[model samples]
Target: MRDSEMTTCAPTLLELQWAVRRDVLGLADGAASEYVVPDGLAPQARLAIYRNTANSTLLTALRLTYPAVQALVGSEFFEGATRRFIGQCPPLSAHLDSYGGSFPDFLAQMPEAASLAYLTDTARLEWVVNQVLHAPDGKPLDLRRLEQLADADIETVRFLPSPAARVLESCFPVDVIWHAVLSRDDSALAGINLDADPVWLYVHRGTSGVAVDRITEEQCRFTAALLAGRPLHDALVDGPDAGTSVWLAHLLASGCFVDVCLSSQASRRATGRQVA
Candidate 1:
């Protein structure tokens, strides 16, 4: 068929499918072979190189983000595990930072990694650390503004947490596992129970790099509620039964909540009048 006639006939669905497969999966076929320039190498060899390069680049990114997890699994084992992971779950975003969010869940199900039961939780902790480091920064809420509200109005005061704050919970002693891998300090690992109930962790950026700390259940619930835009009184109500005053004071001191908003329409109207 003439070139013009072929074009007018409309490209076959098979031709379109091949193009998409080549672009997305880096697949090699007769159509794709036409574009490749073989330099003293077989076409299959060249295509194999492309496959290796693609897998290696993604593996390197996962390694950088989860160095502690890599160390725990050893280089060879980690590479094999990551290869399986990448095959099952290719990156979903252009940003590599968000690439490994599902790695913990992936590790949890891998039978080969079953011996290191804590590995999955460790991966989760590392992912959370990365997320907290990249979270946005914001100013601490003004305590003086909080004081201006009447006792009845206090319950209507909604909280906004700093974008940098993150919470992580794990059944394994993930904090201990993280420190052990990163710091080469085993002291934190002592007395760690892999089967214990999940421990809650909070991470935030302070003056230095990201600071990670264990948090009480009450604090976890309170901060989680606040992060979800809950009002102060409602947050406390949802939190564990403890001293509300002390928990609020600690949250303020930690610079966790960034701002307060009016949860009630009445408060909004009152504040609008004051602004006017």
Candidate 2:
């Protein structure tokens, strides 16, 4: 049979499941309703339960990920906007914490945002924070090994960022906005200059918790390039902005890197105690 013929034919159980998901997310009309046999109550009523649960779970997930966005916008407005977002973007990851990564893009294009020009950037910052909070505890870089290496290896050396590291660049003063919103400091928030120039941030998790720190553009460039798997030499001289040893020192002190390698193969730091 042809492609059209397959759709016209009766769907299997798996196809019905996909159709139900599409309908639940409001991506399709209620065509799946015809397939669901009414059990005690109408099929639509049963499906409504699933919709409510899914929507509620998604709302909670977004609330956790985008707390600043919720605090910036009132609860009523946030819930309304998130509901629309949920309909458009169904959860792809099994983990709720992994959802809502695209919420910043959604906020950027929202027509209702009149005076709140910074909401989108604020959301982007929040998403980075959320990622750092959930990132795995990967092997940290061996600084002793790095320091012991000869000057030649250090030049061509590659470093991998800790799984928890994230860099964000935004036109708005989103770090200040995030701090004000999360801390509930009305004075700090009121004093913000929304039209400030672009800001670069380095986000990471530590013993103290997730830290979002403002950084220079040069630091941002170097850190971002290393995160992109570029060698240290390339990242240092890759752009108009040049990185210094001070920047490298600062990042290393912040525990930004997790692994180092002289060439392509990674050189992991040994951690386990000697076993019997």
Candidate 3:
């Protein structure tokens, strides 16, 4: 049958789904025109209702994920920006919570958000906060086991950060801004100097909930290297002025890592052995 003939006949389920999806997204003009409606109901009008509902629900999720951004830009302006964001980045998964992973990058590229350099970084912090909150719980690495390792074994072993741990490095004082917003203290927000130096942050679940801590450059480098799967010896760069013991103690105390494993090469190097 011809394309026009198929439309005249009953629409297939797949065709109907595509039409509804396009209408919800405000795409083609006549994607939904062929649909059958009751006498009182208008297809375009009904689709408009659905379009509004879909956009509203997705926008709500975006707002929740980036509340700080919404607050920085006023509610009305944020809503308008969010509508634009939704049009460009639609939901891919059934779960709304999994959405907006690219929103930070989207804000960075948005023309309106261009003036606010810190906006993208703030969005990133918010996303990491959400990720930490949803991450599964796990026990911290055991200190006793770490202490028992021989010096050679220590260098050959690797450290892994907990599933919930994340690092955010920003040229702006995003941590301070996020804290100020959380505290709801206008004075604190005013006192924060945006011209401050760059910041390295360690975000993870603490005794309470998600905890954000400002870390030193040295700590950032070491933790980042460890997280990248580098063995401890390779990761231990001599920059942090802080002694190795102090850095190690702080890392263990923070509970950033959940497990430790010896690299296979560690054994081979120990006994002058080689694997075939």
Clashing pairs in 3: none
Off by over 4 Å in 2: 1-13, 34-37, 147-152, 238-243, 266-276
Cα RMSD (angstroms) for every candidate in the order listed = 6.0, 6.7, 5.7
Cα lDDT tens digits for candidate 1, 128-203: 8888787777888789878788888887888777877877777777887788778876776666667777788888
lDDT score at residue 105, model 3, on the 0-100 scale: 92
TM-score-better candidate, 1 vs 2: 2
Each model's lDDT comes to 0.77, 0.84, 0.82
TM-score of 1: 0.77
Looking at model 3, residue 99 earns an lDDT score of 85
The global Cα lDDT (0 to 1) of model 1 is 0.77
Q: How close to the true structure is residue 154 of candidate 1, measured as C-alpha lDDT?
A: 82
Question: Which runs in model 1 stand beyond 4 Å of their true positions?
Answer: 1-51, 144-152, 186-191, 195-197, 240-242, 264-276
Tell me the tens digit of each residue's lDDT in model 2 across 156-181. 68887898998999998999999998
At residue 204, candidate 1 shows an lDDT of 80
- Residue 121 error for model 3, in Å? 1.3
